[model samples]
Target chain A: MSTEIAIHIQDIHKEFLLSHSGSASLKTALLWWKRRQLEELKVLRGLTIEVKRGECVALVGRNGAGKSTLLSLLARVYKPTSGTITINGRIAPLLELGAGFHPDLTGQENALFNAMILGLSRKEATARIEPILAFAELEKYRDAPVRTYSSGMLARLGFSIAAHVDADILIVDEVLAVGDFAFERKCFAFIEEFKQKNGTILFVSHDREDVLQVSDRCIWLKDGQVEQEGDPLTVLDAYESGTA
Target chain B: MRSEFQELWRFRELLFAMVERELKIRYKNSVLGFVWSLLMPLATILVMWLVFKVFLRNDTPNFSAYVLAAYLPYQFIQLAVLDSAQSVLISLPVVKKVYFPREILPLASVISNFIHLLLSLPIFFIFLFVIYATYGFEVSPFTWRMLFLPVLLVITFMLTAGMAFIISALNVFYEDVKYAVSLLLYIFFFLTPVMYFSENVFYALKDKPYGMLLYNLYHANPMAMLVTAYKKTLVPMGKIDPGGGEGLIPMLPMNWPMFGVTVAITLAFFFGGYALFNRMKWRFVERP
Candidate 1:
């Protein structure tokens, strides 16, 4: 794989105004400035990173350490408030369990819609449905509504569709945290396969072994900034020891 | 902005799938299904016939047909805009999880409701046929100009979509948007030419200074113009009853210049709505 950069997130800062009550109505919004009930919650503060094409990087962090927020920004689910992110290829993100699944839609329908949204054409997504359902081991429930699926089933299907997308970069969060052992193994195998195909990956995890097994590099985020980064074993050791 | 359009074009297939999903979910497991969809307008026709023709003793000849021409379009406007107002809020979880053209959320709602509007059409035609046969009404009111139904619908679509974009995005920030929108529609129902004919408004403003301007202003409300245009195209502008019966309001001539202005403004609303949505989309995830 060429060493060209695939993802460039530079000097990114993201902040959310922690509203005690969400300003979901005009009446509240009109009084929002008057009440002064908002507190600034800065999730990612002046963070920067770059991922080369075909690299697999894992992020390990404590809860609220900004790892998920960083992954979301890369996925383009949330834009950085005070910085620019330049991505050079199509991105397929598996951010949560059944991220885009509609409860009323059949598994097959959700698969097609999810795959299409991830940059697959109708023909391409249709062709991949069998393999996707097969990978998720959901062939028996293909026509069943997604709402009927368990959380594990949802994760399996979400991963299967993201695996099939024709994307150059894949961003993942704790989506794999809920699936079974065999499903997790299958996901790791797919990540290895994706890496071999020159795909860039950025993933967030709480598992140390997952960081070591899949990531060539590991980044430890602390309070929205990169505290440490480099060889997975070294960073993992640092992260674990530092947390301990 | 150009990139946004290009991205939306690339996801056009997804848009249609979303529209299909919306339609499927509306009547998901109900046994009556499509019949349930037709029942609302049918009931509207019945109530109009009972109240206007029987109870009020109004002899405008084919009364339900007139009310329906206006009522049907208003339903389309209300259904599309109201559904769109909640579209983003309902899909917030998915919005925070994935990325597609955010505009698709509201666009799908508008389109599915447009299909609902299309599905509602046959009932109107069926009611018209029944009235013609039962009442021995004068020669059929439909003229060749009925071909312009699609053009009138297109204008109404632009107006609703524009309003949907603005409201759906605003709703994410202000929860009151949906309630306010329904309230606004209630007010507009009275303002537009839904219960009565456009000719009534024209005659009311006939001779006074700035009367033409006032008429133009009323038609500028796209809903008002759309319903009038629907009646003008569907029912002949000429008199339906030569007997000069009670409740017989004259039909107004099609105002070509005002129509041109309305079309331009409707296009502006559509684009303006889209622009506002795009501006607000990136911040949607912040509140959650």
Candidate 2:
């Protein structure tokens, strides 16, 4: 593993505009034209962290603690209002599985499309179809439209496609929690292999045991700022006792 | 913006996949499938020909060909803009989860519709040939001027893409942008010279004081110029030989100045749309 930084976060601040009413509708938008009130919700406030190359960093936080927001920023899904996030390599973000899948498209077709969107060429994606299908254990149902798929099946397909992307860094946000036990174990095995190959990982999870097993370091977030950061067991202990 | 376009180019494969996905989804679960692309414009041409030729009794020679040349391109723009207006809003899940050039969503819609337009071109040519052979109407032979068809198609594409970018980005905030675009298309359909000829508008108000101004202004619409250019290229005008005899071949009355203006306007629309979209795109992730 290179001793360079894989992910760098510097003084990142993010603010979300909360509309008082459902202003997307033209009627409400017109009605609120003059008196519209927008509440700015600061999700992240001057928070900064860095993950070295080949490091597995777990982000553990309660609901609404900005875990998802921080991951989204790292994935470049949203720009920070006032700070910077620098990622040195290609990113494969397993945020919400099947979020880009067209429900009307068949599993095979959706997999091809999703893989291409994730940065694989058509030839590369086609070459990996067999392995992807095998990993998802969904070879028989490849022809069915995803609308007919169960949530678990959809997650499996999404995970399979994302896992195949040739990426230097992987960002996982609670996606493994939706899979079956065997699938979760398979995902961890793949993560272990990925770690062995010196791939950097940033993950958000509520599962304490999974975090301790997968991550060498942990960052505990509270009220949109880092509450603790150290070895996984130490931070987890501090986070648990602080919450309790 | 240059880097943005470069990034989009790097993800060109994704753009192509998105376009393929859209085309596939549109035809899925349908019996006729891609044939609908041909049948739709053909059906519209048929009804338009009937109303103009039989009901209204408008005696425009080669009426089917004329209506088709204008209507096909107009339909392409209409469908592209309308569909793309909702592209960002419809892909909210992907927009919020994944990180790629956000412009690719609406651009994919525009490209798919451009493919549909390309497919329908053969139908237009067939209509021209049929009308020329059966009705004894003089049809222009393929000429260097015919090369302008691709140029016209590209301009139409750029114009539609620009509008799509602006409308789709706005749609992330105001859902009414889609309806507004539909309403604009409805009104714009009449403003362009699809149903009538630019010459007729000129001839009708020839004696008025501001007749020439109105005439020039009417033809100044970029869409009208495109439609007229398409008609000139496809629908031929009977020309007289110097020997006081009617010529069998047709000639196009090329309007180079109007075309230049249309090209300029299209470039403006393309750049303006991108400017507006890039400016408003940051708010997209913050929207619900």
Candidate 3:
């Protein structure tokens, strides 16, 4: 309940039921009714974490360590099985760049749609369209369908829209890994500026140097639970040595 | 439920944007563009007219208008339900990436199809005017009853939207929901009094033991009642002077009390569909 706590997650446990037959057709379901099997994949098990206002926290873990699951839960994209999550600020999630953009829409149109989906009004999204296009360096291709844009261009537009939302909390999940070096540098600069403006960030990345450069604190998830947390270097060093 | 509405209200802009996206993408590459909406229904009306009036030698006055009125709305509901059934599955990426009212996706489909239905209305009116002028069909002038068309349209929208919500959410869990819906629509087309008049069903089965039961069952469908109500309110504009000309076939003999019952049933579907959708939506994220 503390006012300073930007995100409060308590004893979070996430279990996904993996259907053996991926087809959701009624015929398949009826045929498999007697032999239907669901294997529960426990992604996050009783992991507790609290992120404070203006804190930049990085989650580092190997694949299947539930790093992305935790971020998704925090973003309210999925509900925890038996725990409560309280987020105190508007969140701008860059989980997967251009995940919501339609291929048929122009770059500017997709940016506006993505911004509105992230909680901006039509007028507000329209007003920010110019700045977003400018930041993404997509002015020349603003009218072109996004299907024609390169992957780097899509990432740029996605990052630009996410960055301009002016949200209290920003969640980035390895989105920077796709951008080119120059755009990555521009993104890092924006992240630093965002931090200076008192924004809370929950970043997930596998890059060691990038984690060290941006985060004030680090949480290492291991086998669905937090193995270590606190000082960035200490935890990262321990995590690296353990993985190595 | 109240909080859900409040949340939907907060994301109203997103809803509008989604609907706009659907409409634009639907007609994007087609040369005819928006005109296709009018042409598709007109083509259906033409085929139905040839089959009923020419081939069968049917004698229903203003048969073209009657078929167009019923068929246009039927096509709208069918398309809306069928397309919206896949709305959630199609937007899986967006659903997993962002947090908004998931209902907006299916709702947007409903609204976009509703727009198409609205666009086709003018063509329907023009068809009616042409039949009256050229064929000397007994067409009533516009009347005060036409004001009730909007109410009937709203009821139809609510009914289709509700079905879309239920089918689309269920579709995420069972992909066959779309196929099953399409099959059911086919059966429903024959069951409802769309292609034929309700009076035909009554007269054909009048001597049978369950004749009344069969007739009542036909009118029980909300869509049937809606079509009947639409014909009553919109098709028959005013009473034709009996001394000079023949009047249209008594507004297709609608059952008023059953119409009220159908309205209540549609409202119930809307509430039930909304409840089921809200309950099942959290499981959507769990699905692949």
Q: List the residue pairs that clash in candidate 1.
A: A24-B174, A24-B175, A25-B174, A25-B175
TM-score per model (chain B): 0.91, 0.91, 0.92
Q: How close is candidate 3 to the true structure, as a TM-score?
A: 0.95
Q: Which stretches of candidate 3 lie over 4 Å from their true place?
A: A31-36, B135-139, B237-252
User: Candidate 3's residue-wise lDDT over B1-288, tens digit each?
Assistant: 889889999888899999999988887778889887887778877898898778876666677777788888898999999989999999989888788999999999999999999988887788878877785655553557778878888999999989998999999988878888999999998887677766666666767999888778878899888876776665763221111123333434557888888989899888889989999898898874
Q: For residues A9-93, write the lDDT of model 2, one tens digit per residue.
A: 9998988878777556666567766334677788898899989989999999889999999988887888898998788888988
The lowest-lDDT stretch of 10 consecutive residues in candidate 1 chain A is A21-30
Task: Report the number of the highest-DockQ candidate.
Answer: 3
Over the stretch A108-204, how does candidate 3's per-residue lDDT look in tens digits? 8899999998989999999999999999999999999999999999999999999988799999999877578888899999999999988999999
Clash totals in order: 4, 0, 0
Candidate 2 docks with a DockQ of 0.63
Number of the top candidate by lDDT? 3
Query: Which pairs clash in the backbone of model 3?
Result: none
DockQ of each: 0.64, 0.63, 0.70
